[model samples]
Target: MSRKTLIPIGPYHPLQEEPELFKLYCDGEIVTDIKWETGYNHRGIEKLSESKSYDQVFFLVERICGICSTSHPFAFANAVEEIVAVEITDRAKYIRSIIGELERIHSHLLWVGLAGHFLGYNTVFMWAWKYREPVLDLFEMITGNRNSYAMFKVGGVRRDIENSKIPAIRKEIAVIRKKIDLLTGAVMDDPVIHARTKGVGILTRQDIIDYGAVGPTARASGVDIDVRRDDPYAAYPLVNWKVITAQAGDVFAKAEVRLLEMYESASIIEQCIDALEKMKEGDITLKINEIPEGLGTGRAEAPRGEVFHFVVSDGSNSPARHKIRAPSYTNIATFKKSCIGQTIADATLSLAAVDPCYCCTERMAAAYDNSSGKKILNANELIALSLKRTSELRKSGTGHE
Candidate 1:
């Protein structure tokens, strides 16, 4: 007879940054129940944003999620722009898109590497991370920081994509594009990986609709929605690109959508660069005075999904109320639908499928046994248990025990 046991992941695991705690209940090898807790870091960023001026909030929001550093600020900037009622220059628009696309490339590649690590595929992890370096290098060259690129401003972008650097950047993007194609081919062609990922954590299209899942998580489930395509902002409206989707709604489908989206991201960057050449250079930013009294809202397609920001201004430098909603908010909720009947092995990957900001998830989390109300395994033990499941699957040639 199988007995129910609880496994907890997070509140400061070595591999995680967000400090989340997941309570997974298992009977033998199958997951019978699941629960999640978040909000460990709780820096009060929204309330903190209320203290800062419109210009200062850009830097503040960038710190919300290191992985999603640009996305938050990007959305916040859009909100501020809406408040002021101004359009950025054509050059500024292209510059914004360039940075955004670069961020997406690096982010998706990093996710690929992490997913590989979870499956005990170190080679895939290495190759994916290797391709991600050039993207960070490009960020450093353009915005002075690899992690928090402080280029987003209220009126427009703070940095200009120079003509001299365009050739070098384009060459790097082309190189990265080639590597991405190779990686995508390798992942899709591998059979063992398919067994581990395909149909493992299936979130039905109905689950996505009910939970409001976004980004690749929703796209993988065949729900076609992208902020860039549906509601265009920055240079997204000007560029030629397509939103990628997959119908599987499993971990593999999530991976496929992200990998395919990389090509689109690279192409968008290329188009933006070409457009920049035709537009006036050094006109990347606009001048704006005091903010008016009104509500301003903005949304941007982050690497994970949609990043939304709502700001209310009352003729002051600081926002009267600032609300930020990361894609993972609704995305994480879908776990209740995807993880309930999965094996313990698939639970971690399913959560990772959302490409959540570890710190963001950890910012608010707690874990305990549902049966007895006692604290169970911590983050490291939970990870070990999940990895052990993969190891067993690899040796047995069957994912379920």
Candidate 2:
């Protein structure tokens, strides 16, 4: 009998952008079991949200994920607006949706580039990132920053997409559309890419449901669910676009869904830009003085999946209780299903298939001592306790692996 060898992937790995630890127990080249650790990047964002006022929280949450920067603010705005119960103007809706969709394109392109780099296809990486610049340029043209765009607020956006900038934005979008077509064709038709990813890292529709995965991860598995369509927020309902899905549920399918979704995002942006041209500018935000005591739940379809925010207002400027859930929290859990039967060479690809964002996924897991207001457990202690629990579950025949 071949003994299983332990291979550790992270806490810090070249492939992963953030700190996370994945323990791969393998028999020669085949992975037999897996365990993972998080909490390395916890920022206490929810608790921090309690300290900031309603207006300032947008800026705070915008830093949650650099790629999904607008996503956090969009969801936060939706949650707070629900409590305020104010109807923003049509123009505001158009601008808000434009920012959201543009962010989607930017984020998808970024993932494509990173995925290529992971596969050692540097040409695709270069091409995808080159096209992604135009999307960020559009963001900088509207907002001042390329990454943390502080545009969204309680009822509307902070800045307006002026009519004068429409022509330039349209021209850039046209160029980006052509580049996307080329990149999509190149990636989709490549034989090497097909051989590498077609059947690797597959997550079934049932697996997605079991893991509660969202975004492209779930959509690629033929689980047709998009919060933009299901919940109907911003200008997603106003514009004409369809949710992208693929049946295969493999790494290739996830790539296909994202590439195709870029077209939808571009289309949505163009429609929004046309709407912006017709409507008068400067009517961006509603005057929301205070939020009455209430609970509000808001969700946005981020590039990864759903970005959910729950806000409890105690009739104050700051939230009484704020909770955020990023899509990777659920999507990352699916790695156990997708990678267990695969070879070690394919394990990293399986992990990246969901476009996992460790920073966005990190949440505090109760390490604090309530009486002393200090941490009771260290990292080593946490890991030992987690391993102990897993062993207990497995010995009891209640665990999957």
Q: Say which candidate scores most in lDDT.
A: 2
Residues 297-367, candidate 1: write the lDDT tens digits.
Answer: 99999999999999999998899999888988888888888887887778887877788774543332236
Model 2 TM-score? Answer: 0.91
Q: On residues 110-213, what C-alpha lDDT tens digit does candidate 2 reach at each position?
A: 99998898888999999999999998898899998898889888888889888999999999999999999999999999998999899999999999999999
RMSD of each: 11.5, 9.0
All candidates: TM-score:
0.89, 0.91
lDDT of 1 at 158: 83
* Candidate 1 global CA lDDT score: 0.85
- Candidate 1 residue runs with Cα over 4 Å from true position: 361-401
Model 1, 254: alpha-carbon shift in Å?
A: 0.6
Count backbone overlaps in model 2. Answer: 1
